[model samples]
Target: MSDSYPQSALREWRAHMGHPATLVAILGVGLVLGVAGPFGTDVRLTLLPRIAYWLITVLLTYSAGTLCDAMLKRPLARFGFWVHLAVTALATGVAILLVLLVVNYIVYGWLPDRDSLPAFLGTNFAIAIIVSVVLATVHRQSTPVEIVSNPVRILDRLPLDKRGPLVALSVEDHYVRVQTTRAEDLILMRLSDAIAEVGDTKGAQVHRSHWAAFEHVTTARREGDRAILTMNTGTDIPVSRANVAKIKEAGLLP
Candidate 1:
């Protein structure tokens, strides 16, 4: 069950990080760095080597940061906003440093001697923090637009303008109440079927009567042996004892 946390977090991370615009931005930075040279290295290298170096470095750093983001999400969230930022910045910095070390060794046969590794790590680590902070800011600004453009298929039952990012679904007798960021409405359907139709939206049945989208969850709190998901809309949805492990594995609880 614990093993599933990383996988689920990684899936969620990929969903956000795989945006075409993000890829294009990373690629553009790499191209510019390659052409202009990083730390005056391009002046000594040919066009092909310079391009390859920057491209590989950017790709590796991006991948490492994504993985670190997934792994550190829950712990950082539990630690609160400021701590989350600091921890993520530090972890991403170390990851980028390591990636650069390996990439440089492979590409340029430049193995840092033991005496030089500390300075190399420090320099790359600083670069990593700056890059990660910038990327995070960009993603935050672009995310709302992306969410608005990509409508969820499961929300087709709602009116055109009413549909938004899904929040939660509650089963009320024979009908399922669909909650979105914009509003809530009832549609005749079983919770199980609704869960199936939700498709790629990351969510889980927290209780027999309730299903909550991971993205819409603002917090998760424990009550005795059960868990409760506090959604973005400020509604608290209860989690059954049976689903506690499932919710934890989804990284919805810390």
Candidate 2:
């Protein structure tokens, strides 16, 4: 049985996919292409080659999904994690097949003229299922790294190793959440200065008190007067009214 975790765990998955908006965009484009393929000239290919092509597409999508899942130590703890993963995987497969269909249509006039529509759909769905299963298994097999904390490096010292990666620090009550590796580290420091010191990682202060890793933010949601950033960890970080414009200008918002 799978263990339970918070919704925040999905942050990494969402972020790695380039966010929900990106996936939706990919799917929309795929749908348009899939329908257009039937009129393409390459429709003469036999059933066997078409099957092979779809299988290849599944493999590619599976690889991409597995790569994304590998980034998280544990899978996202949601009510329907497996279901969601399966859907996302199949959707990704469809998007890929649609792209191929569109390509065939543009280059040629008809696609799979030798085969029926039912056969193509059947083949694509079957391959999607297989790829999704393989990708999920691969994700389950990934090894997770253990992180240890060092409490000695408090604000008492001036700072010794300033040359290393700039760790953007923020104190969240008792814990200091350091935004790095798209993972958070509990440390002790003020958030204000931490954002200024983080040199290598490109990010910004989405909130008056919150510092966000630019690359880590997958999507931004506008909730009334407030803006929330869905981070790599899936936790929503509020974007202060003052910083909303700047974050939008940075292209962090959809």
Candidate 3:
């Protein structure tokens, strides 16, 4: 999968964390919350301290959420949404509450009263469920690669972002580097089997280990008895003498 596209729950969360936009989001949301000072934080602390408080709290919760998502995946992968939400809320709520105990102590100089512990836990659970649902929704947005006429079996092996119109395929040991208009991916499949899955795409195996789509062949030039085909992606594929006729027949060469 592309690092940008959302995938499995944990992986998707991790990928998002690596994006620059995620940092922007974290900083923006922290600033807003600090200014607004939810739960009386604005009243309790000065402006700079308020911003610092929310910023560190935001950072802690984000780290806790990532950890909780990973920990809960194995147990919840087979479960449905309600079960996931309830369990996720509990797990993440507990994890964050533990860390927040220290944060609260540092900010306020003491924890909430023992009698108010349940209320604190409840607040954590509510926040956890909201964050869980949003992350789950992001994870669900990934679309699987679809292939062939009915569905190409080989294209399914490529990542979602790499699934586009056919370009070329090249063999590298046990793997075939499948290229589409969008990008290329190395799939663990034979060149022959990959070509069989080309379906409606008009292309030919121009070399013993290379295949080129006719529509994507940008230049075809004769090289003595053999030929060279340059694809739209600027990949030059050497066409063996035996396949020269096929390339010519496809009008890839004059």
For TM-score, the strongest prediction is 1
Please identify model 2 stretches exceeding 4 Å from their true place: 1-169
Task: For each candidate in the order shown, give its overall lDDT on alpha carbons.
Answer: 0.72, 0.50, 0.72
Q: How accurate is candidate 2 locally (lDDT)?
A: 0.50
Model 2 lDDT per residue over 1-254, tens place: 01123333344334444544445555555444443433331275445544444444333454355343333323322324455466556665566567556645654455666556767667766776676667565433222232234321322122121122322344454334454443333333456555544545667776656776677777788878778787664456777788888778889765
- Write down the RMSD of all candidates, one decimal each: 12.3, 14.4, 10.3
lDDT of 3 by residue, 17-125 (tens): 6556667778998899889999888779988899989988887887787667655544554564457656876777777877788899987997878898889877876
For model 3, the local distance difference test gives: 0.72
Query: How far off is residue 37 in model 1, in Å?
Result: 1.4
Worst 10 residues of 2 by lDDT: 154-163
How does residue 59 of candidate 1 score in lDDT? Answer: 76
